[model samples]
Target chain A: MNPIANRYTELVGIDHPIVQEGLGPFRTPKLAAAVSNAGGLGTVSMPGMPTDLDAGARTFREHIEECAALTDRPFAVNIPVGVDNNGVVLPFTDIYIRTVLDARRVDQSLAAQLTVLTTSAGFPGDYIGMIKDAGLIHQHKVGSTRHAVKAAEAGVDVIIAAGFEMGGHAPSKAVHSYVLLPNVTEAVDVPVLLTGGVRDARGLASALAMGADGVAMGTRFIASSANSDWHPTYIQAILDAKEGDDVAFDGVYGPCRGLKNAASLKLLNHQEDGTGEVIDAVELTRWKIESMQRAQTTGDVTDGLVLTGQVAAAIDDIIDIAHFVPNMAAGAAEILRGLASALPDTEHAFS
Target chain B: MNPIANRYTELVGIDHPIVQEGLGPFRTPKLAAAVSNAGGLGTVSMPGMPTDLDAGARTFREHIEECAALTDRPFAVNIPVGVDNNGVVLPFTDIYIRTVLDARRVDQSLAAQLTVLTTSAGFPGDYIGMIKDAGLIHQHKVGSTRHAVKAAEAGVDVIIAAGFEMGGHAPSKAVHSYVLLPNVTEAVDVPVLLTGGVRDARGLASALAMGADGVAMGTRFIASSANSDWHPTYIQAILDAKEGDDVAFDGVYGPCRGLKNAASLKLLNHQEDGTGEVIDAVELTRWKIESMQRAQTTGDVTDGLVLTGQVAAAIDDIIDIAHFVPNMAAGAAEILRGLASALPDTEHAFS
Candidate 1:
């Protein structure tokens, strides 16, 4: 394999500067392993609060083990810094984090494989050292430049700067990709990966041009053949998706974007102002986030939410997971080469 | 000069694939000519409603004549189709369109230089024929894919797809640049130019990757030195701007983005119910749009509105207007070359 060098690739030891986003609350072991084998940093997203702390840890451990068994390549696990609406820490976060950190301690095979930890949602300051101490790269995702600066200050190894267009739990600040990407990349010293509204090679190439070292895509991965374990109709929902198919859901700390359907519409319609008689907003938010995963399993487009980014509108066809990253890498490579070939003969370089 | 071939450049007869946005509601004769002369399409934004219909037409004609006097290169004029809150068409739109069309007929020398008419705010279907019959190129700017299809069906020569992040009058739909751009470009067959949130060569390169033929920047142009005719402090304001400094003003059909100064704050806070108000909301919106010009002339940063896009937050320094397009061109060229040189040999390229 030809090594395309970048800070993100070097830091994570990946062949391509692409990260598979943590899609929904699922143990996507096959999907993650498929991406990693194809030379991209595949990430297994921590599933929603399991029956209990033990179940949550067991689920995370199973995912890590399953992915390790499938591929010899390095992979990462995403654990959102679980925090409630009231800024209080939630349960199951520690259980999940320890599962990834101690998985190598439990099994030597997975130790070298699960080498990276990506934390999102809440602040990473308290956990950055813990992650680093475990001998893993800590990459934190942020929604705004202020949050990015905060994440960088916390001594995170890398920053995944997400825009408002991302599916699942997105940044509270509604800053778009092009606007937020350059800002965070310019502000922080850490290598930045762009997320949200990115679907293909052009999106990846555009991220590199925007000063991001790599890209982390969630919606694109959902449409991949490797994720065929999900309902075929769910994948079909993504392909049949058109512009403006996504809507916002008040989940966790902020709004999460996903395909608008009966489930999502119900979330939108629940515009509670707390004036009504006794409503658990935070619990309801958590339930809403958890319910989204049902869409893929139940194959119900209306009752369950199909979490995807605004980029879903542009995705006309589905590609096999085997070709996804390589295709994106090669397309970006060709685009850059094409642009290079078109360069004018000149000594003048812009500062 | 090496010609960067694109539909936007070829259609508009510009060397580089860049278009300077029509700024504010005043005569920008010097600004328009300088960009056009510098091998990019410079646009003269139609001045706001004059004292009367005769005065409005006269001011537009004068601005067109002045732009023609400054450069032999082609330039365009932007006429926003003003629509009120109650779905009423505001006055002075027809007069302005006629003025642009008849100006060339009034003075044959002005005909070739003022070649394009870009209609925004409302539908262009009503006046597309009049301009086409006048033998002028019709380029309309729309905020969404639906509007782009409508404009294309209206027989316009080009589609300038503007995103929600744009300054001044923006679409009611809050679709972002990457989302709106690819959507419109895919939906319509016409040549598309991405507007809003573009600052430098990276932004232009990203737009090209997203399938846009070119980029039109309003906030970036405001920070240029060639625009020295405006107050220095105004440029300084743009330089000092940070992310989220720009916000939406509920003017006309949608929000008008600008620096969140005293004037914009007042507009936002003026959330009228239209219950018992004797004032016309349409006239109020028009006045708000017109009053934005005072920021350049009066230099009252607090009281007058400063129209700029989200990209303003990233701009730190100013360059001469002469170097703007060339700088962007060279920077994009270098970036493309750099990416090309860094590419690894691969057998994969996405179809």
Candidate 2:
């Protein structure tokens, strides 16, 4: 028996409700397969926005195929919907969503393996219908209760409540998890996953207590042993981060959380809400993506932006995913049962 | 036996581990007594510092006596430790601590009723010795794991982990509850109570799951029906708040969370980390405190600063403390038990 399985696990066909959420602008094929092998839902991330849309789509397909080869368990792909200020969907978002749908059409085994499509950053507008028609569980991440309600009303299967403390590309509303999670859960009937400030079993149990069906973590998964695909220095930076060492900077999307290094300070110091300078907007976007990739590809902790969650301070060790995932769920189950049994029967005093 | 009794409730001699934490710079004697009478630890707030230190002390003593008279159950007094830039204890902090100690020394009944002392803002430093010597349970509020460890090492009986989302004067570190609470619980042996972003039974259960002994709330208590001492408009403003309405500005202490009104904008637009202009430091400090008091006394929520936590968005109705406190604890225990029992048995699947 999976000690913490619920509707979320049953819907996703995973043994545990835990998920290694998308850590985009970086690669996570190996990390995704490792978590899936451990009986938790894993996710393949969207690579950085390269100049060629077709090349970006090819890279995404390779990552999915690589993950399917490693584990037979079902997994997911995260595509952050990029919308322009004029509300028009960006070219990359259009290309990536279609890439996944077309790839699944060509191969039946790949279609079965990649059963979930997760969207973040912006509202997936009409893409929700396409994903649902493609026989994929649609999970849309939101930072506000209003958005959660709107998404649920629009037939989204799941909602991932993204808090301000979440890693790369946080909610523009800046709502913390403790205050936002319950509001999202209450607003939507579909399963809700809390995405921010979660590190271990205690966090998973706390998420359940706050009315979330499960937890979707990014930083914790980034610091695990299965993330050997990432540079050692990137993982070390996360382990070495202390409280207040992280800051939110203007990312390609909205505000992004990362270590307080030289590269992030450069972004925070300039840019006066798009009023300071009339430089190349496209160039600036590419630079941000390149800096993030540089950190992961080459171990440059100082100049490269190390996107991480606030929970990075609490994480010191690199965990082995296979053992850590199941142990975490089991531990959370034990804690909940233990606390219930330990309640002192002072009912008469309360009356 | 209480449904949620633990080291914290046992230490404070309260039926439940819930605490209506300090909402200082405002009178809360009636509100404090109502919570204490309802079986949770209630806290009498420190009155604003008038020009006369002696007068302020007299007012604070009266508030404590009023709370003691209203409730035979044990209660607490919240006195913020104010220290100057040079690290000298401010006159107001010194006077208020002495007033609580003197009141307890003279009247044995008052001493028995006011058993707990909570100190926030600055570190208690040498005053820890005085509080312990006076036979009061010393619970210091901290915003980081390092400070929690320091307070626990200095003989504090309990630690209230104040998150960045807390109302009034928040921690300088700005750590959120989910990220900081577990870190504090792991760093120290002292029973930790999570402060900030907590409202109902779900928050209480989440706190336990995160390893905290209990939860302390300021914004949740401020919106209660017992807080009639506050202007009805102030409570209504909190009720009307939606997400992203609250902002952290330059407060008397490091930072403060409150509604985004005209009063808070005045502070945020000016003052460049004490380097922009020659701000009459004392005058600015007095004006800030006066504005906070003005909102509480008068129903000027728009013009006067309305201090509140981000959790205000989640709270819509005023609750009766007599029914809310103990029932919240019971509800949390039920939720914990329900979640544990709902876990599906799939251990063989993981193996």
Candidate 3:
């Protein structure tokens, strides 16, 4: 078998460069353990989020400890840097970041195992040195090449070039993965993990061929059995989708790609009337919490949004994580081998 | 506001539905006149065909005297159907289709108001019935929905359901058009003109939303000054397509979707295992002559098998046809106006 030869596999020490994103509330200990056990990086979102910095840190410790008990493989935590809409600085944001870092520092077992820390949303450039100094590899997610260059220049260990096609909160720049991946790969010296619209082995092989060292999947993993804690309808909504099914909506700081449904439709109509921007955090938070609870508790797909990538086109069937991840790696390896075998023989090595 | 109430529309008194297939050599003046001026229906392929179908039909005193002196509107004749297959069949299929149809047809005049015939491969479907049936219409082309079913559904006046995502000889069975145009518009009432990957306003408004009264096009038409042909490179390779950019060698009976390069790759590696049924005369002729010539004449797009449906994704800029066709019917009468607005409402009606 042709092995996956990439800087990501070497640096992350995973068999394949598939990294699971930390989807908050949905990123349970079970899902994280399954991803890590499956030979890809599994990440846990900070537990009991929006709590005070100390409470959030304590929850993070308990969760990391739970994951450590389940799988010995490396896992990461995603810390979204809180945005300051007004000029007034929020001390809570700094406390949260510092508290998460301190929590990781104090736990010897967690520190030894948490090989990567991915900071997304707001700028992570200021904290990259501190993250690296904490003895964890620093990874930053950027939506554009400008941001990618900024992250790389800041000495981030890896840059996640999240394309417009990806799920969760995508940047508003709107460059497609086909254009973004190759451009960032050419521009950056560090290993690039291609995120967005990557769902299968063929996608993996295609990404590698396009020069990405690895891929990061959010929607695909969320639909897996390990993620069954959510409503089956939520999972089914994702499974039923094809490439163009999802459209992005403007979230708090940026655009988020999700299944377009009643709620989103309302949001769209509101935007059309210029009423969407006025929704404050309290209203947004209540809507999100209610939507998630209804979706999770009652299996109602229409109640909330399920984040997804354009790669939904390729995902017709959903399989378990145990079978899905390794099979993806193997299938990609096989295709690469076939590609190599098909290459034409050439002369002029001396030249 | 108008709405497209019906999926199919009838002209004159044709028994079958209305569809305008690409007619290459088979695009005859007799054919166009027989289908249209007779009232049943008709279309002439685009001009510049090698044969003198345009001139030949004009020569017939009765043919010229009767129809050429009457009618006004657009008709169609197909551009050459390019295939990336090396000249495996002798005598060039496209030339034969072009020559035969061109020799038989006449240039459209005001009175006759010629509608063009378009064939993706070889000659267009037979036009004897259309000629015999006065005022009857005949347009036949298909990319999906079982070519035979699409072609033979006796109720259809025109049957062209080319997937908006297809490029060239898009066989219908492989990938469904949104799972096969709502299952072939619920298995045909009449008038189904569809083509692979038609781009633009009327394309979306009419075909997908309205269920198509008639639809016919060649890729180059969009690139025309009358259209938006764009850069030759953009037109040729279709802007840096991915590996799955096209589907070829699908083991189906008709042409497949894809760019010339991917098609060429498949052709070079075609299996000689002989486990499958031998290709028939029509299939062989289409592959060897008709498709090959078009590819050669058209250049690398044909070479790369650059037939595309997904190219719809990249076609953001609007062309003139984008403005014209809509206005034509949009301003027509209450009946036409109703048809114009029907599409979006129908699409939204589902939700």
List TM-score per model, in order.
0.90, 0.97, 0.55
Clashing pairs for model 1 are: none
Q: Give the alpha carbon lDDT tens digit for every residue of B81-164 in model 1.
A: 865667556677888888887788887778888888888888866688988899888888887788899889879888888888
* Listed models, DockQ each: 0.45, 0.67, 0.02
Least well predicted 10-residue stretch by lDDT in candidate 2 chain B: B342-351
Docking class of 1: acceptable
lDDT of 2 at B113: 93
| Candidate achieving the largest DockQ | 2
Candidate 3: list runs displaced more than 4 Å: A48-53, A86-93, A275-278, A344-351, B1-351
Quote the lDDT for B313 in model 3. 34
Residue-level lDDT tens digits of model 1 in A76-178: 9998887766766667777788778777787777878899999998886677899989899999998889989988887898999998888888887677788
Per-model interface RMSD values are 3.0, 2.2, 22.3
Tens digit of per-residue lDDT, candidate 3, span A1-351: 214545687788776678898676443677888898888898877543444657656676677678878888888877766567663334544664576577677888777677888888777646778888888888888777778888898899998888666776777655545446656776799999878766667566656644577788987887787876667787788778753467677554567667788766666556545545677776775576456446655677775766666555445566688778888877666554443222221112113
Report clash pairs, candidate 2: A1-B345, A1-B346, A1-B347, A2-B346, A345-B1, A346-B1, A346-B2
Give the alpha carbon lDDT tens digit for every residue of A60-98 in model 2: 999999999999999999999999989999999999999
Residue runs of model 2 more than 4 Å from their true location after superposition: A271-278, A346-351, B271-278, B345-351
What does fnat come to for each candidate? 0.50, 0.87, 0.00
Worst 10 residues of 1 chain B by lDDT: B342-351
